[model samples]
Target chain A: MSNASTRNRGIPNPLAWIGAAALGLFGEIGRLAVFSARVKAAAFSPRWYIGQIWKQIVQIGFFSLPVVGMSAIFIGAALALNIYQGSGRFGAEQFVPNIVVLGITRELGATITALMLAGRVSAGISAEIGAMRVTEQIDALESLSASPYRYLYAPRFLAALIALPLLVLVADIIGVMGGWAVSVFGLGFDSTVYLRNTLDFVTRNDILTGLIKAVVFGAVIALMGCYQGDRSKAGATGVGRAATLSMVGAAVLVLASNYIMSTIFVEVGL
Target chain B: MTTPILSLQNVEKRFGKNHVLRGVTLDVAPGESLVVIGGSGSGKSVMLKNALGLMTPDSGKILFNGEDVTQAKGKTRARMRERVGMLFQSGALFDSLTVWENVAFRLVNSGVVSRAKAKDRAIETLSKVRLGSDVADLYPAEISGGMQKRVSLARSIISKPDLIFFDEPTTGLDPITADAINDLIIEQVRGLGAATVTITHDMASARKIADEVAMLFEGEIIWRGKASDVDNSGNPYVDQFVHGRAEGPIQPAL
Candidate 1:
C-alpha cells in the first residue's frame, strides 16, 4: 500500500492539469484583449508619429507588393486549372471564368494575401520588436519619456490598417488576370470572353467584402506581432519563440475572423 | 535637511515564488553619486528599475523629491521620466538609427528642436563623451562596444536630467576602457549636478565613482556607508565580497 501511494504521488492528476491549462488559456485571452484596447487608445490619442507611420506604410505595403503579386498569380493559375478539371465532369468548363472571379473576390484574394503577410510581415515585426525588448531599447524609450505604444506600436498598427486593403485590391486584379492567363492561353479559351465573364460575374459587394476582411486581417497581424514581441523573454531563444508565435497566432486569427465575418456577411445577404 | 532626490522605502518585488527584492530601502541626495554593488541575480537591477518606474515594486513608496510617484501614470509618469535618464547595459542604442539620431532622439521626438538643431546638439554631446563628429553618422552596430557605451552615455546626459541610473556601465569593456568610462561618468554627473544611482559588481568602478556605496545581498541592502569605508566595513559580507573570497558566508550558486 505504501509503495502504491509513493507511485501515485509522482503522477499528476489529469483533471488538475486540464484545469491549469484552461486557466492559462483564459489568462492569455484577457491579456490580448487588454493589449488590443491599449492599441486602440494609443491610435486615437495625440502625439502621433506621422513620419514613423509613413515609413511603416512604405515598408508593409510597398515592399510586400512583389511577393503578394507573385502568390496571387500562381494561386490564380492553379485555381483555374483545378476548377476547369473539376467542372469538366459536369460538362460545364465554360463556367471557369465566373467561378474564378467569384472565388478570388469573395474569399481567396484577401485570405491568401493575409496568409502570405502572416508569414512575412508578422514574423518580421515580432523579430524586430522582440530584439528591441531583449536589448532594452523599449526600456530606453520609456526612459526617454516616449510611449512605446505611440512611437512603436500605433504607427505599425495604423500602417497595416491602411496598407492591407490597398494590397488586397491589387491582389484581386492580379488574381483574376492570372486565371485569365491560364484559361485563355493554356485551355484555348477566348481572351475577351474570359475578361467579360469575370467582370460580369463579380459584384461590388464581393470586392467590398474582401477589402473589409483585409482590414480586420491587417489589425490581427499587427496586434499579434506587437503583443508577442512585447511579452517576449530574454535572449535569442525568446526572440525566436516570439516570432514563431506571432506568425502562428496571426494566421489562426485571420482564418477564424474570416470565417466569422463571412458567416455574418452571408446572413446579411452581402 | 534637503529631501532626497530619490528614495525607496521598503520596496519589495517578487517573480513567482522567487522573492527577488525583500523590502529594499535606499536613498540618494541631489548632486550625489551612489553605487550599488551586488553579485549577479542579487536584485540590484530590479531595485534600480523600480526606482526608475520601469518596474513596479510589490510594496513600496518611491518618492521623487518627496512626492510619492509610486503609482504615477500618464502625464505624471511622463513628466517624471523626462527629468530622468538611464545608461543601459549593452548600450541599447537604437540599431536602425545613426549615432547622432539616437543621441538626439528625445529632443526631436518631443518637438523641442528642429532636426538641424538636434543634429548639431547630438554632435556636440558626442564630443563631450570623447566621440568625434564623424562617428555621429555611423550606426550603433558600426561602432566598437566601448564606443557604444560612450554614445549611450552621451544620450543619457543630453537632457541634463535631474536623476540618472547607470546599469552595469562598465561590465563588458576592458579595464582601460572601463576606467575611462568611470572617469567620464564622474565628470558628467558633476557637470550636470545630477543625483545618480549606478548598479555594478565591479569594485573598482564603485570605489572610483561612488560617494556612498551600498551592498545588496539576497534582495536587501545589508550594508551601506561612505565609499572610503567600503574597503573596511567591518561586515563579513562586505569583506568577503570586497576581497572576492570563495569560502565566505555568501555561497556561490551551483
Candidate 2:
C-alpha cells in the first residue's frame, strides 16, 4: 500500500513584502481622498477642530516620550565609540565630542529616530482606525449624527503632529548624553573637555533644523499610516497590508524629506 | 390606520451583475411591525439595508414622511438615522466598549445627553430587556450568546427610535431562547408603538413578530399578506421557504 501525504512547500519570496507595501500606499491615498470628500460634504465647527489639537497632544505627546528617549540614549553611546575610534586613526581623538553632536543632531538621532517611531506608532494608528472603518463602526457613527473625521482622525493626526517633535527632542538630548558617556568612559577623553567641545560645536541652526525635520517627519508618518489604514479594504488582510505599507512608506518619505529640508537649509545659509 | 411613514418605490440593487433587489417596492405604516421572510440570499437583508441607506438602491424613490430622501446626505441622512434603530445579526455591539457604552453610543455621539445620563438610560433599557445592571459593565464577548442578543436589543431600543430594523433577531439560539427573544421583540415594539422591519428566515420568529408578512423570492416580494395567512400562503415559493423543503422553485446550489 502506498500512502499519498505530500506537502507542497516552497520558499517564500522577500520581495513579496513590496506588494504589501504598494497595497498600503494605495489604501492611504484612497483614505486621504475620502477624508477630503467627507470634509467638503460636511463642514463642522472650528472649535471641534481645535479640540482635536489637544487630543493629538494627548495621543502623540505624552505617549511616545519613553520610547524616543530610550532609542536616543543607545544611539548616542554607539556613535561616540565609533567616532572616537575613527578620530584616533587620524590623531584627532579630541574631535570625537564635536563630531558626535554634529553627526547625531544632523542625521541619525533626530530624523532616523522620528522615522522609526512613525513606523511603529503611526502604523498602529492606521490599523486601529482602518479596522474600525471596515467593521461598519464608522457608518454606525454617521447614522447617529456623529462626524467620523472629527471623532476619529482629528485626534490621531493632531497627536502625531504635536507629539512626534517632542519625542525627537527627547531623543536628541538622550543621544548627546549617550555620546558623552561613551567618550568619557570608553575612550580616555577628559569629561570637562568633552562637555566643553560639545557645547562649543553646537549652534542654534543645528537644533532648529532637527526640530524642523521632526515636525515634517511626524506629519508624513501620520498621513501615510492613517491614509493607508483608513482606506484599507478586504478586512483583516487589508489591515495587515496597510500597517506594513505605513512603516515602509513613512520611512522612505522621512529620508527623502530629510534630504530636501537639508538642501533648503544649506541654500538659505542656515 | 396611520399613514405610511416609509415607502420604497421601484427599488433595485445589484452587486457586480448579482441582482439583489429587482424592482422591489414596499410601504411601512407608522407603528406597524412588517416581517420580511425569505430563504438565504432571497434579498430580504438587502432590502432592509437599502431601506436604511446602508446600501443605496440603484434606481428608486425612498420617501420618509412624504419627503423624497433618495439623494439626501450629511445632516439630512443623519437626522433620518436618528429616528431609527437597528439590531444586526451579529449583535455588532462595539467589542471595545462595555454593554452600557455600546447601548449609549448614539446618545454620546449625538451629544443629546451627558455621559452620566446616557449610562442611566442604558441601565433602564437593559432592565427593560430583563438584563440586570451587572451586565452593563461587561463586554459583549464576556456574555453568553443569548445575553449578547439581549444587550443588542437594549442598544437598539436605548434611544427609543420611531423606526427599528431587526436582521435575523433570533438567529443562532436554541428554540426556547429564540421564542423568548421573539416575545421581547413583540413586547418592545408594542410598548413603543414604533414601526419595525424584521428580516428573518426563521418561520417561527416571523410568525411571532409580524403584523404583516412579506415573502421574498428571486429578488422580489413573491407573497405578502397578514401574518396569520403565512401557513397557507398560495405562493409556491412562500410555501416551500416557510416549510424549508429542499424541492421547490428555489433551486439548491450544487
Candidate 3:
C-alpha cells in the first residue's frame, strides 16, 4: 500500500529529499543575508527615528536589568563555590578569586545575559511584530509611507546593539561582586586579598572579549526576532509560532555564534 | 474622459499554482467610488493589494496618474504610497498608540505637522466621524469595534491623499454599526474628494456607498455597471452573489 501511494505521488528518492532539504536551508540563509543587508541600508539612510530608538533602548535595556542582575549574582556565587571546592582538592584554593573573575569577564557574563535576552526580548519583539503583521498594521504603516525596516526594525536593532554591551558590563561587575561576597563571607577568604586578586587577574582584554560577544549576540537576537515576525503567517496561531521560533532560533544562533567568535578570538590571541 | 487616477491593465498574480488573479483590468477615476464585490477567495483582496502597491502583479501594467508604476521601488514607491491610503478589514490600529496618535500617525511620522497640531487635527477629524474627543486618549482595545473602525478611517484620510482603498470596511459589525460605518465612509470619501476602491461582499454596504459596482468571479471582472443597475446586472455570477443564492451557477468551494 505504501509503494502504491508512493508510485501515485511520484515520490523522489532519499537522495533527492536530502538535496531538497539542503537547498531549502541555503535559500533561507540567502534570504536572511539579504534581509540583513536591507536592514543595514535602512540603518544608514538619511531618515532616522531617534525617538523610536530611545524608546526601544529603554524597553530592551532598562527593563531587563533585574532579571539579568539576579541571574548573574546566582551564577557567580555558584561558580565561586565550585571553584573553591575543586581548587582545594589540589591545594590551589588561593586561585579561586582569579579564576572566578576571569571566567565571568571572559565568558559567562555575556553568554548568560544573551541567552536570557534571547528568551525574553526576542520572544517579545517577535510577538509584537507578528501581531502587527497578522492584523495588517504593518501594511497600514506601508500605506502611510513608513518603512517597517526603518520604523519597526532599525530602532530595535540599534537598541539591542547599543544596549547589550552596557548590560554585559553591568552583569560582569555584579557577577564579580557576587564572587567576592561568596569568597569572603561563605568560604572564609580574606576580603582584601580576594579583591586584590580579582582586580589583578581581570584585564581590559577579558572585558573587551565579552563586550564584543555581547554586540554580536544582540544583533543576532534582533535579526532573528524581526525576520521571523515579518514573515509570520496570518492569525493567532501564526503569531504564536513566530514567537516560539524567534526564541528557539535566537538561542541556537547565540550559542553557535559564541563558539565561532570564541574560536576566532583565541586564534587572534585576544 | 479625464485620465484615471489609478488603472490596472491586464494585471495578473499567482501563488505557485493557485493563479489567484487572471488578467484583471480596472480603472478608478478621480472622485469616483468604485466598489468591487466578490465572494471569499475570489481574488478581490489580491487585486486591491496590487493596485495599492502592497503586492506586485505577475504580469500587467499598474498606472497611477497615467504613469506605469508596476514595479516602482524606493522613493518612487514611497511617493506613490503617499498619494494613497487604505482602511484594512480588521481596523489595524496600532495597539500601542492612543486613538489620537493612531489617527495622526502619518502626520507626525512624516514630519508634516507637530505633535500638538496633529493631535488637534486628529480630534477635528474624529469629530467629522462623529467621535468625541473623550476617546482620543484611549487605546484601540478600549473602544468598541465600530469606534475602532472610525479611528482607522480617520487615520487613512488624515493625509488627504488622491486615492483610498477600503478593504471590507464593515466586515465584523452589527447591521446598525455597519450602516453607521458605511455612512461615515461615504461622508469621509466625499469629503476628501479622493478616488476610492472598496472591496466587499456586503451587498448593503455596496448599495449604500458604491457609485459603480464590479463583480469579480473566478479572478475576473464578470460584470460592472452603475450601482442601481447591480440588481439587474443579468450576469449569472453577480445575480447569484447579490442574491446570496447557494443554488445558482456559483457553486460553493468544497
TM-score of chain A of each: 0.97, 0.81, 0.95
Q: Best candidate, lDDT-wise?
A: 1
- Worst 10-residue lDDT window, candidate 2 chain B: B88-97
Error in Å for residue B7 of model 1: 0.5
lDDT of 1 by residue, B1-254 (tens): 99999999999999999999999899899989999998989999899889989998899899998988898988888888889999999799999899999999999988979999999999999999999999989999999999999999999999899999999999999999999999999999999999899999999999999999999999999999999999899999999998998889999766
lDDT of 1 by residue, A128-148 (tens): 999999999999999888889
Clashing pairs in 3: none
For model 3, what is the alpha-carbon lDDT of residue A248? 95
Top-scoring candidate (DockQ): 3
Best by TM-score: 1
Binned by DockQ into CAPRI classes (incorrect, acceptable, medium, high), candidate 2 is acceptable
Candidate 3, residue A251: the lDDT equals: 95
Worst 10 residues of 1 chain B by lDDT: B245-254
lDDT of 3: 0.93
User: Could you tell me which 10 consecutive residues in candidate 3 chain A have the lowest summed lDDT?
Assistant: A8-17
Report the C-alpha lDDT of model 3 over A86-200, residue by residue, as the tens digit: 9989899999999998999889999999999998899999999999999999988888889999999998998999999999999999998899899999999999999999898
